[model samples]
Target chain A: MKLMRLLCWIMVFCIDVHVKAEETHKEKCDFNRGNCVILAEDGRRVFRSDEILVMLAPRALLEIRNENTVQLVKGDFYIETEQPVKLQTPYAKIWCEGECKGLFSRTAVTLEVKSLDGNWRITRAGEKTVYVVPAGLQVSIGEVAENGQAQMEFPQSLPWVPTIKQWASLYPGKVSEFKPELEKFRQVWREAVEAVSVLHQTVATRAVASHEAEVEQARRQRLAQLREDQGLRNLFRDKNP
Target chain B: MPLILYMRLTSFLCFILVMMLGWMQLYSRAREIFNGTSEIKAEIGHLKSTTAHERIAMALEREQFLEFRQNVATLMPDVLKSKGLGEEGYPYRSLASSISRSEAELVRQTIAKTLFERAKDNFRQEKFPKAIHGFHQIIDHFGFTPYVADSYFLLAESHFKQNELEACTGVIQEMVELFPHHELTGFALVRLGRIYQVQNRNEEAIEIFKTVMRSFPQRDVAAQAKASLKGIDL
Candidate 1:
């Protein structure tokens, strides 16, 4: 019996650990209007995680599947990442890696991926073959074949890529050239995150403290009840004797 | 009899232990539910606070970008001259220079477009003050962009909505002076005429209406001007 009880407890512990391990980490929208639209008509919406940053052009729709995967419903996306990430569209799944900077766009009948600064591995939705796309190249997949796979075009050199100089000029004093200012912004972001974490910790501690107090009160009541029941049993025993 | 009593006592103790365990299980379930509720409430509170913070942060970013753009715009003329490029040569330059003039123009256009859209949204939401501010920002800092024409008209409209007739007239006159050939200039003239009529200056209103009718003949602005004239029995 003791062995069985011990096995049962061990199984419970293992299951608990397995459930925690299986819990998926979801990505949250960091910046955008409530419906994932840009705040301004011409502005882009930004979503960030620890590993990747995604910018959605106006009218683009993106859904987060997990920490490293996103589903692009339609429209254009500019993605930058320091880790491998997956972009899912109706036509294909694009796996990007190693400081990836890419543009992805999808429409009802087609999908396009451009690797501006990194590498991409694309597999059609129903196909087994994967195609590699290198930096400064683009791939377009259009129309499904008889075997239910989209036909991917040969990777070709991208027609145009925005230069670093152009990007810096577009957002002057905010990016590339403005290291100190960016650092200041990052500091603010860190402080805000720390403040929120502290607030969460305080709230959790208060809740746990209140729960402990309630449990202690209930335990005391149960002990009193048990004592009274014991006294009644003793009186009954004496009477019977 | 003694052995039977011992078994009875042992069974009773077993029953007590099971009952205690069941009670503990029930208490733990209740505690879980309580903790879950508290966690959900805390999450909701955190989300609300974070959303507000995000909005403020975004607003600050926009403000910073706008200030940067204004500073860049102010320095652009001198920079162009120093590089031996005409002021009108802005969009023809390459990135070889410290500041790419074409990129600067693109940035200006983007800021102007964004400001115009935001002002339009504010106008639709009936937030005249914020709308006026945005339109003014576009006109003051991004005057070279195409949105300037629309911004001028909207600024006048915002002032009109706020019943600031004098300010409305001033903006309309400025729009007409700056963009005499612009389609919105005709509209601005007609609006100015209407403002004159509202101030009971019928003669001046008629003169403005006649100007609109003469300059914008066979257009929507002429029709609007004619309607205003007929309203005053001209």
Candidate 2:
């Protein structure tokens, strides 16, 4: 037990050093978490966690500090990373492991995993069997022996589990006295939609402008061709005559 | 006199013939330029012009972009009626038409950011209840998104401020569970330990602080956890 504790201490020390080193190299770029940002490295990932635990070396190595990882313990997390990394759930030691680069989330009753790039597999603990999870497919890997099939439906939506939306009837999360005040953000939501729409419009406009410039250039070239043909004909008449 | 007049007529005829020759030469030069063989080579030096279909598509996109930008600009009133603050005016202006998926994602992310900031502002202003509500909304709407984690942490803080220990505990537990390797997890653990201490659950608090020391030895949270443990021991 002493030896194990010593090893754990050494590992934590090494990870701490590694985390400090990454502070200089990684920039968050386009990455974001909630309304704030934690790490700015690589800009391709987002990390959402309350704390670090588990057998993994460190969040820094996995680029989790910069949105490269999805911590689905509290809520769902979506991130995109160029670097290849594998995922292990809290029950990863007992359940499964696989490459991840997409959306991953969990509720009290179920864990869902989806990959956008390609297919990956999650193997059962201490078993030879592996479950292949294809890209764009969502699956809830029900307990270890549940035959690793990916399911499309979320548990919150199931008849038995009620969500905040269905809480008047009964829900999964603890019942709260205060509602989310969803109605309050209505105007901001509308503005958000409008902002996105406008941004798209700008892109389309630029594309059109580029195309128009090309057309004008083509017209000039055509006119030049016609003029050159006329010139050549006159020269030929003079020579033949 | 008749001999002199005949000489004048010959000179006039010679001048007319010279003028005709000059006219012929000028016409020939103009026609060569018009033939476009040399001009074509000169004009298309580097540019490989786009196809007709491509040009048409671009024109259509440009037209749509203009229309969309105009429409979005006029979309809403600058002032929004929020829950607590009625008819609050936003300072920024609106912009629109991207055709690519990546561009669309960028726009979506930008909007999420705007909403996230608004929620954060509520927290910074000491409006704990309103902030908690706002953060919850973000998590509910944008769960599994980059905003979810931030919302979770802030929501936990909001609950902590309101002295809602149970709710705070639940939020922190969720954060730690979801993000076992995140930096905030260390902070959450520390917070959890403090809460435990407040409740006089010394042993449980010690365990949580030890977990932080074992997991994140270099974090300030670890130091705080160690201090808490020492305080408990003394």
Candidate 3:
């Protein structure tokens, strides 16, 4: 009886160890949002136009067909399509196997779908322009204007400029003591820019005047004085000549 | 008569022993079932809480980003006009460069705030992958912002949520390595030790929990760690 009880205890201990080992192994594979198991039935699952799929696979060529539209979030496998595909994102790089028909949001998230056929036309809103997306082209959202000009655009800049009051609060001084000096600096800067604008406008408007030479000379003189007042010695130092 | 009495006593003692052992086993089984059910419920609650928080946070971020875009759109035209350029002729590259550093600082703060919110919400939602992605985005885009330490904490939480407890160990391990003096370090360490406990890796859990108690004696996490150590029974 003693021997039988000891055997039973050993068996229980072994089972417990085995269960823990299994749990640990299960956790190992489920680490990377690998939680979802896509079954064969998922292939037939129809996703709606607004449904976005972020493919986790590094190298997957997903073949998705939609009657409406789809947005592929960043870090998804590229889509290869035979039909014209309309992709909307800040930008998209799609490869078309057949006719490429799609609209892209002109915002930074533009659709760049590649096509097997070299013939393609890009329409921004209503403006349609015939263009060739080479067999393996990667196009961004914006159009390269005529003359092959690329307009370099920056991302949205910052908002909420620190007011003089806001800046003063960071320091140990009272607002009354600080505001006047800051305001004076701002006013001086504004006046200096206005003086430059006035000179430029005068030069532009007097171009067809009979006293054009006189206007030009006066504009130069004014620019020189304005530059001096603003302590911009390099700007109009030679204008005295 | 003596033999009969001795036999009766022995039989009585045997019966009592069997009854006591049976009761002990029953009590142990009940305790095991209760503990197991409690853990399952706790996990379920964590998932539900995380989902709700994450949805709200992501929506908030998207709204804020859109607002930022609109504000920039409205202000850009004015800046372009001041520069003597029509919308088409705007020297965008130059104007962008001329934007003051303080302006960039403001944008960074907003982005950081949004990223942190998304990360924390995802962590709460038990969506570890999404939460990790959010933290990575914060680290990638808002690396210069004040959200770095918080991002690390969220990343650790994300890994923990997925039951990638081992993977989580490495992340929190890195967190401690990277942010040695971070205010939340003890909390993270205690949580990491709990992951070990959940896996029945009691020795490692006890070691780490003890370390937390020693290192962060004044912190509440340390107290929790001490309480957790009581369960290890070693």
Candidate 4:
């Protein structure tokens, strides 16, 4: 009787664990059809979950892995999230946090991540070092090098960002609702650029002041050493006489 | 002692009688259950056999019907011509009514398709008048076929090729009213706008081009409209 009771408890525990595991990772979207198009009313194929909102561009293939994770198989995607979300591409993985909005594009040879309004942490596949990309900057990870290294490019200012008018023109039917989101993106991008510029200026000013101080201290030390040398020469001359 | 033996014997006889009665009742119940099961099994067998036979018969019937449709389809054009029956004539109508509706539709589609091909060939050869006649015939008599939209568009093109701007516009407007959602409507609108441009009606042309661009944003229709707009701007 004791053995049977123990077995029953073990089975119950296993069933509880299985149910918890299932609850933790449930698929939010299943878009396996070729090059998913926007058949919904919004003129964009959007997948919304508790953690992130993903908008796929024309002919883009994307799959939501779970609530907070998405895989970009090909083409472009724009993502908005208040919480942390993981974006997986063929060449790299990007972790976005803190009310972030970003555009991610992948192709056969490269994966490009543009931080439109918030910070993004990017790590190339098989690489350990994470590169933090601030808003208004973009990064591209190219095909792996022949020597088994990621060809990670340095972050730079976003070359071109689509305007609200252009996006509205592309999806004319949903212009009313789309315009406000794009306007907010523009405002956030402008603030981020200004913030980055001020930070750069402050760091430059501090570096210049520290360099000047170091130069002044070195000159004074040289002058003191010269005086001591002159005094020692005079004492030697007197003793010789 | 004898009276005790007699009592024991009578008790044994009564017990035997009860055992026999119980066995008889049990046997009757078993026989009833077995008979009921066999009856159900026989009914199931009959249903299975009938279904199999019906399926075979249906397959053979479908094959024979397909053969008959093929023969009728091959002979339909000659029969119509020999009977001196036009497509919309009462005699042809009566003949079409004699066949199944699907078969009649198939015949109409074949005739319309052949007419459309001939008209397209004429248009390609720059025989505008002949092409217009053929397209008009298709539109008038075989309008129910799927080639009507193509016929209308080609008819307008024939008019445009002959520099008959008014006729071209009239045909295009009619087509738009008839087939509002057809893809060719966008192309026809672009053509109409081009005619307007040729007539030096810039404002009207621009409006038509803008309409095309707004209505068919992702298609070649929009691209052509954009090109026309650029030309006007220049």
Candidate 3 deviant stretches above 4 angstroms: A1-241, B1-98
True contacts kept of each: 0.00, 0.00, 0.00, 0.00
Q: What digit string (tens of lDDT, one per residue) describes model 2 on residues B47-93?
A: 43335335434543543453343233223222122221322222221
lDDT of 1 by residue, A1-241 (tens): 4644554564444342335431133234543222232221245556666776776666566655455666676677777777767776656778875766667766756788866555688987447788877665668986443333456875655543242222233222344555663354345435544654575688889999999999999999999999999999999999998
* lDDT for residue A173 in candidate 2, whole number 0-100: 23
Q: Pairing residues by index, what is the TM-score of model 1? A: 0.30
Off by over 4 Å in 2: A1-241, B1-100
Residue A16 of model 1 has an lDDT of 28
lDDT of 3 by residue, B168-228 (tens): 7887888788877666778888887878878888889889988888777566777788888
* Docking quality band of candidate 4, CAPRI definitions: incorrect
Least accurate 10 contiguous residues by lDDT in model 3 chain A: A39-48
In angstroms, how far off is A117's CA in candidate 3? Answer: 71
Give per-model TM-scores: 0.30, 0.31, 0.30, 0.32
Candidate RMSDs in Å, in order, are: 36.2, 42.8, 30.6, 30.1
The fraction of reference A/B contacts recovered in model 3 reads 0.00
Across residues B1-234, which tens digit of lDDT does each residue of candidate 4 receive? 999798668656655555565567667768867779757878899998688556545543543453344334334555556673665565754554443345457777888999999999999999999999999999999978888999999999999989898999999999889987778998999999989888899999999999989887557888989998999999
Tens-place lDDT per residue, model 1, B82-170, is 66377555553332122334454666677689889999999999999999999989888887788888999988999999999899989
**Tens digit per residue, CA lDDT, model 2, A26-137:** 3433323322223222322334333222111111122222333322332344433343334444222112233333345444334565443344555432244566554433
Task: Output candidate 3 Cα RMSD.
Answer: 30.6
